[model samples]
Target: MHSSNLRLEEPIRMASILEPSKPNFFPAMTKIVGTLGPKSRTVEIISGCLNAGMSVARFDFSWGDTEFHQETLDNLKKAIKSMKKLCAVMLDTVGPELQVVNKSEHPISLQADTMVVLTPDQDKEASSNLLPINFHGLSKAVKKGDTIFIGQYLFTGNETTSVWLEVDEVKGEDVVCMIKNSATLSGQLYTFHVSQIHIDLPTLTDKDKEVIRTWGVRNSIDILSLSYTRHAEDIRHARDYLSKLDGLDQTQIFAKIENIEGLKHFDEILQEADGVILSRGTLGIDLPSEKVFLFQKAAIYKCNVAGKPVVVTRVVDSMADNLRPTRAEATDVANAVLDGCDAILLGAETLRGFYPVESISTVGRICSEAEKVFNQDLYFKKTSKHVGEEISHLESIASSAVRAAIVVKASVIICFTSSGRAARLIAKYRPTMPILSVVIPQLKTNQLRWTFTGAFEVQYLLCFSSCSWLPLPS
Candidate 1:
């Protein structure tokens, strides 16, 4: 059903009221990314997520068809417009991912000294296997004495790496090798050359791009998230392709960083893309789990330094199906906020969950709370010199004043910021109250769309442009 068919209990802009004496309130701008799925497709559920502070709704093309996807997109637009919030939607495409073609249901269990035979014919599921190695490229990557790890079970042998072995006996279709640290049903496979295998598909799958284009024309989506991005070219290609569509150039493209290839070309990728997404779920499969956390942190730091928004996502909790998040899960949510990310994403938590509302509420609570302490230290500790000599003296004054207002709990901080530099400063401080920003030039409003404080109350003040508009040291 469309959002029009569903009723919202309250307006989407309604902010939660903490105790009157409480010192903290919501930050100036915090964007939440909620994935769309069975649980969240209903108008009521989608509204609940939005009410819980989701600024953007994402349609994961990996799961649904065109009809379902488009319908959901329409519903979100109706909901946001009805609520009078400038809503943003994102379309995420599933890229070329390696997979185990075919396998048996039985677990390929092995003990120490167990002799397993691998053959060419046994490797074939629906088609023919050209090589004898059970895995697609195990022989090429492994050596005669090299250690072989099969789902935490190790095997070493004197047999030549390339030598073909006949399946002397079979316990199941093939031995499940490299079972992850967690016993996930999504099996892992060893392969050579980890890169995007062109699936002869549109950068945005045919179905997905159509929906994105439609949403763009209607101003439904503000961001286009490219999943499985490998190089700078991917971002360029997406931007160019989308540029051909009407009213879509305003929609920014974000490259989802998941694989090693994307990380190796980080700088170039960041330049070509508007933002980045730390998609840890697929990343965990491609890399060791231990490394994912640090890699995510580095990505966040890079994005923040570059003034780009970054979204950290994955199974931050089991609440996708349960109401309450585990204690550890709560801490994980807090950590993402403390890391200074622009947004934290909820996948199954909001999409296919039993307690969608509760999950969003918990995430909102943790992020809003953590942002208070982290942002305060981050912004207050910086010196005026660190703000750069480039900022005119007056802009700096406006920025400092806004920060002071937040520190003192002013009902509203009215800022006369032209370049938006002043507002960004106020936003970085994680002010507890709303900021009523008065911009000198009307065009400057567009530039602040993604900035920390641009999201606050935007009002245009009458004035002509001037280089000396900001106070100078002289």
Candidate 2:
């Protein structure tokens, strides 16, 4: 019997498959990473996301505790088991970001032009007149007349609840500021920005280390998205830390470019990181709003030439509240797909959004449509030219395979990869046909490890006999 018709009795773990021979196959080469939160933590929602084409489930450690994340992880596993779909799990660390904490369980309203004290003291509970920040050098970092903006405005562009303040005095550990605008403040993590000054902080925090040591190791996450990645050293530090752990040593590290410093050292960071995530939300705050798009294009192009996977987030942020994306947002998603990004990450749109499932479906639809117009041949030429003199053996094989596929008018390219490198190399050539990758089962769990690569689909075979192979069309 032919491999395409071959069937196995034993169960196998597989991700969503793309069949080029079938009319129903939705060929969206760009993957989707959906953030899991209160609104989308249930198995049903996760399953919906999976069916809608979510390739990864991301848990933001900035907001949830170990217990909460563990519950969500369990729910995700249940959904994967029930749906029999392989979805990679990612842990997004808090890094050295600053946030506000209050004594009141409820949000406090701050009136404009009122004086309030901002302290780094965790022991002090925030009141209507005082707010506590997570960082300790608040007083030393700010001087009189310096401006401070607090809220999620930078991240979500929702300025309705954000507060602006101007520093009036620095007293020991407390910085007194006069509120420039009226806004409601909550305990939710808020981005801190000071005008004309760089607040130096460690790349990874104590809480981040604790979370990785405790929750990350326990769950055996597939990816770690290091927030506020400033330099190559940060990536090395994270890799070093993970190397000490048993199962986590294999975890892929993705550096998130969020600030101006990160962008300044992006080349170094990219060389060290397994992948890169263009975090437009925080990047917008660090640079002019208009420049963000330019940076996005440049970063994506570089990652493509380097044969590294890059993910773009905050593409359809408006869909967090609305059922459908705006025309511009839709265009943005399409543009990202056209730019050759490996993945699009949905943060607020899925995390706390009212329409998580619809968001994923919408992005996936946009990507599929945009992919139709992608000039794959041109991209391939450009990528090959960029690799000029130093093409490796794997690159030559991958390039040849893609060329052969095109010349033969093949329906799909199926690659059996042990470390997923061959599949990634093939994907780097930008083949029009879908590439299906088969990986061996991991020894620890006796399950196929689904590492994030540019492959269109993946499957894990327990053994050689258990493989349900699919032959190339003749």
Evaluated with TM-score, which candidate comes out highest?
2
Residue lDDT tens for model 1, 178-249: 211222122223221222222233445565666566644564355778976778998998888778886565
lDDT, each prediction: 0.55, 0.78
lDDT of 2 at 328: 91
User: For model 1, what is the alpha-carbon lDDT of residue 457?
Assistant: 20
Off by over 4 Å in 2: 1-24, 113-115, 143-147, 152-154, 166-171, 176-180, 187-189, 195-197, 441-474
Ten residues in sequence with the least summed lDDT for candidate 1: 459-468
Q: In model 1, which regions exceed 4 Å deviation?
A: 1-29, 99-220, 285-288, 380-387, 391-398, 404-409, 414-432, 436-474
Error of 2 at 133 (Å): 1.1
Report the lDDT of model 1 for residue 122.
45
The TM-scores, one per candidate, come to: 0.65, 0.85
